[model samples]
Target: MAKGKHNPERKAVRHGTEKGSVTLGGRRVAVEKIRVRSVDGVEIPLETYQALQDPELLTRAALERMIHGLSTRNYAYGLEPVGDDVESFGTSNSTVSRRFIAVRQLKST
Candidate 1:
């Protein structure tokens, strides 16, 4: 161990999980949750990093599905299976409609 590193007196112990989804090999895969600690005892959650969430991919998937004539209500049905553990959120008709509208607005602007 490095000198004074992870020392409770010198540094605080941090605990957190690195859990999120990211595109790997063109597939969105959920990262196995990992416990991580900081020298200063800060619980740093890697999932909190917005970059790892891959919103763009989700948006693109939604847009593509919509463009292919898939109804917003049936959006989730068309998604590639992402395992039962991965809760499918943001694929609801309202959310999809909002995202689609946002993209359309962007294109028109």
Candidate 2:
């Protein structure tokens, strides 16, 4: 939401980058965000593009696994291996549980 909110009354003048990280297919990857700039140079990210970068991706993946009978304790085992070069974290049982609860709370609100 921080990067991509747009004002339709304005005209898009150019494209710019907003670097960030996002998880795709269970692997966290770096991304260069594409944004539309107004004549005054105010960057407005594309809604669809920003949605692809939502951090809830990991939470949703964890929830899907839970719905399919994978316990939170086994969450890490469910992710696609990112190899030795990538430092792995955030897949612990407690972390997954917390993420699931957070998402539920957000949905309720």
Give residue 97's error in model 2 in angstroms.
1.4
Residue lDDT tens for model 1, 8-108? 56433445565565643223566656555667556655565446566677678777777788988887678777677764466668887888888889999
Q: For residues 4-81, what per-residue lDDT tens digits would candidate 2 score against the true structure?
A: 877566577668577766676554566666668867788766777667667778878888888999998888778876
The candidate that achieves the highest TM-score relative to the unseen native structure: 1
Off by over 4 Å in 1: 1-14, 18-50
| True-structure RMSD, every candidate | 5.7, 8.3
Candidates in order have lDDT scores of 0.66, 0.74
Per-candidate TM-score against the hidden true structure: 0.58, 0.57
